[model samples]
Target: MPSMHRKRNKSLGLLELIAIALGGMIGGGIFSVLGISVSMVGVFTPIAFVLGGLLALLAAYSYVKLALYYRDEGATYSFYKKTFPKSRLVASIVGWWVTFGYISTLALYAYTFASYAISGFEFANSEIARKAVAGLIIFIFTLINVWSVKGMGKIEDLMVYTKLIILVIISFVLINNSNTTIPKILHNHEDINILSIVIVASLTFVAYEGFQLVINAVKEMENPRKNIPRAIYSSIFITTLVYAIISIGAILAIPFENIIQNQEYALASGAGEVLGNIGAELVIIGALLATSSAISGTLFGSSRLISVIANDGYFPKFLTKRKNNIPVYSIITMAILTFCLILSGNLVVILEFGSVTFLLVSLLMAYTNFKIRKHTHSSLIVTLLSAIGLMSGTVAILYFEAITKVEQVYYIGGLYIILTIFAFIFSYKRN
Candidate 1:
């Protein structure tokens, strides 16, 4: 077999690839979703975390096959375009939706970062202060990404590993301080059903969305076929364990209402109660590190994706400009859009949008993999099951929106329509 290694001026190794995925996955996702998951299903939040990991694994199956087959830095858009070259519409839809998906997540991570960063201050919950801080962090990371990818990767490694250690320690401390056990909590709560767990698990899919960041870094990585799957799977598994442990600790130690009330910074607040100022401070530090790296990683990989799409002519050609192999304009564009979203300051809606977009995109990816399963040597049954899993996630989100926030469903629907229109216009112009 020919070596899959590609000689380049610089390359990222298996560890770095894993860092990118972990950095992306561990961002505001856990911080933001922990409270909601716990509220929806108290003692079983850890179970939901494991189920979420399973769903992520299923999604990664198709992404790994497509990444190996195409080896295109474009990732989602590139995979779909190459798979169905004749359909400009398909390319356009995937391109716009996926790019915007990253943008929404960027906004999310920054917002979550702001929440934690300001949590120590008297004005922590102040909306204006939070948005201002969020915008600042986004600008700071955009500059860091523009400076260099290697530099960004190093920072990501430092932050990701450090936070993982902090998270594990905090989990242990919280669990030890708890007066209750999982069995006690479970036995006391009889109303929690399997269906509720499944629903929350589906919602947890957003937490696992970052594994694909590895694929987006194909151009910078060594032996992608081996490293891509290794990095993605390993990161997801590690993340699952981290999430499960911490979530169990939080649920066990803190009252459910406290978690729900301080949903944005639940862990930190709960830790304060369980372990006093030191414990709260420790969780805050972990969150700050987690969200910080996430913002950096998302900007680093997604900017490259934007450049790839622009170069393909689906987006403005001027966005293809690069300096020292950096997509400066693309990075700026993403940062500005993300800042705007932060200014809007609709956390739940933004979270729902990001999760829904990725779920739909993953579903499409599964179908694409199934279409060329023979060439990719993919398992027919697994690909089909992946589609089903992704579909169930989409359904779960839509159902939640319909019952609690019907207006958000309409808002998301309207945004999709607008995105589809832009995709069609650009794709048609390519002719």
Candidate 2:
């Protein structure tokens, strides 16, 4: 057992790095967002997924540049802090926002895991039962991570690759069983709003949020410069393809009403109806593995960043507590807060907040890269475009929420206010 600052042997290869990145990106993301996307864009759901991937790719440009330049495992916060070393406030704000962003995603993944786990039970729709299950899973993974680093990595590889295979199989099965065609769905939705498609695409960016997890693995990777870009770009491209095919199969095989009706367990319910019980079971297994791995990977990376922030005095010193080379306090704190969010049972609002936070942080990253383009070997044009694209995504999601879910807008706004206050308080204390 080693302490927090002890350097372990770097054993992860390129494949394992890809597994971690994919595991982080795919968890509960597609399962959670598919229904919302279809509800907004109708037959154009797959198109929105593609557009969302493009936005993610644009954001990755800045992140990869920063990762190569700094090569620090602190990720988003470290990039900002190193780029603007004099601005402790900038570092504190980025750290808080990025940490909470990961927390929201963790909560989202756990809640979705619970949704699928209990989908077949008589009390499947019981909110209380769902929250209880969510808490149980988070606690389970927290223990796994705090127990052993090697075990977590091995389990992540197994779960990530296995779930991907299941997802691909499910997509094909649904497509084979379909009674409808793409053209027919398109013709039926000919009157759908184009703006609606763009808005859904912006919101769908949340599903592509985990690619940055690769940069967080810099300390454990073989080659930071090469593997970082290879893993991220490949993961995003593969994720986009998988999501597109799944959305296509889903819409053609099942009705949109069922998807929206069973939003939490959309694929499971849809598969049950079209391909019988085994199809449904396969989907359940895939969702479970996807989210389980996501929970583990997110906890692993996020706890490290938390430790880094705490070391800088932007967070409570107690958060730097470690056991057996793991950040025990940070991991436990994230799990508890995530469980509380699960108790809130407002997955929709949580999803929106997660999206807004990532988009804003990404914009900041792009701006930081733009400011120091010469050193990072980044392009001014591409970095500027990344910022513009991310800015539009933030505005699009907020505007869409205002028009459709005004209450959610207030909820997101209030969360930002609380986070901002904590950031400044800790930052001032550090000074």
Candidate 3:
């Protein structure tokens, strides 16, 4: 008779890391941002996206350095713990907040998918049907995640490819239509300012959030030290180029005022103007896939967060159960919560709340980078500059919204703060 010990799964290879990075970065942001960014920056929207991409690259560099040096699964939480060992509670808070941020983002994307899907059908136009469809979409993706991580990964790969193809096709079509003039919308505008550009850039930056999801799967990466950084930078470069082209095409096709007034599906409308009805339809389908993929990837990554918290004894042990290596219970829980959020039909509010929390997490990550530089002798100059860029960009966005959309900002922030406090108390009591 012989006994054998089971071996744990190893690190992810370069291709797998690229898959994860592409899956994360090519989601709802590109699908949804054209109209909004154009409204804010006019024909300069493409420039704004490029500027945001630069900042995202800096953040990605910081994340890669942290992941390689620390070589742990906690991502930002791990960085914070190592840098601020004396403030473990703060690290825990940041970790919990990041989990909440991702979950909220998942809910937002689910709601967006539902809204778009419903719009495509007669049922979505109806209030009740819209909510029902939204819930159904959320639940279905949740189940997909619960069933198997491998299955979810395959789905994300397909989605990333589809999105990339669609973006390329649209870019080609728009560029081919050289007759389209770059509308001089900015010439007449009085609102062009640094603050406005920063706010728009921040919004554009959010589209790049998925790059870090690759790092979360670092343990699953083969030679994460080598492969992960390449994937992160490569994905960012490709996505940034795609986004800039799309934004430019959109502004060139449609006038700025029209985009502002028609904020819903602005990018698709612009594509239609450039490529006719067929191009617009393709863009819509692409947007649907983009939102669906974002929700799917968010569910996949967010469930891991819950699994981590449970493994740490911060949540019920049942939540940590991995059926076929997937956290079934946590996935189902997140799906249910996401379903409820979709039912509320408040995607914008959910997005704002998610952005606020995520920005806070980024702030903490920046601080962590600052602290860890002393230990690793990593480039302190780049780290500090990145932190400043992130914080300033986040504040600029928040400030813009606070001035013009004060009520929405207050409501979303207040709700997130309340939820954060309650979650903290619950975790502390359980401990």
Note the clash tally of each candidate. Answer: 0, 0, 7
Cα lDDT tens digits for candidate 1, 155-200: 8889999999999999899888887877788887889998788888
Candidate achieving higher TM-score, 2 or 3:
2
- Number of the predicted model whose lDDT against the real structure is largest: 2
What are the RMSD figures for all models against the true structure?
2.2, 2.0, 3.0
TM-scores for every predicted model:
0.97, 0.97, 0.90
lDDT winner between candidates 2 and 3: 2
Summarize candidate 2's per-residue lDDT along 252-286 as a digit string, tens digits: 99999999999989999999999999999999999
Name the regions of candidate 3 deviating beyond 4 angstroms. Answer: 1-12, 119-130, 178-180, 374-377
Provide the lDDT at 4 for model 2. Answer: 31
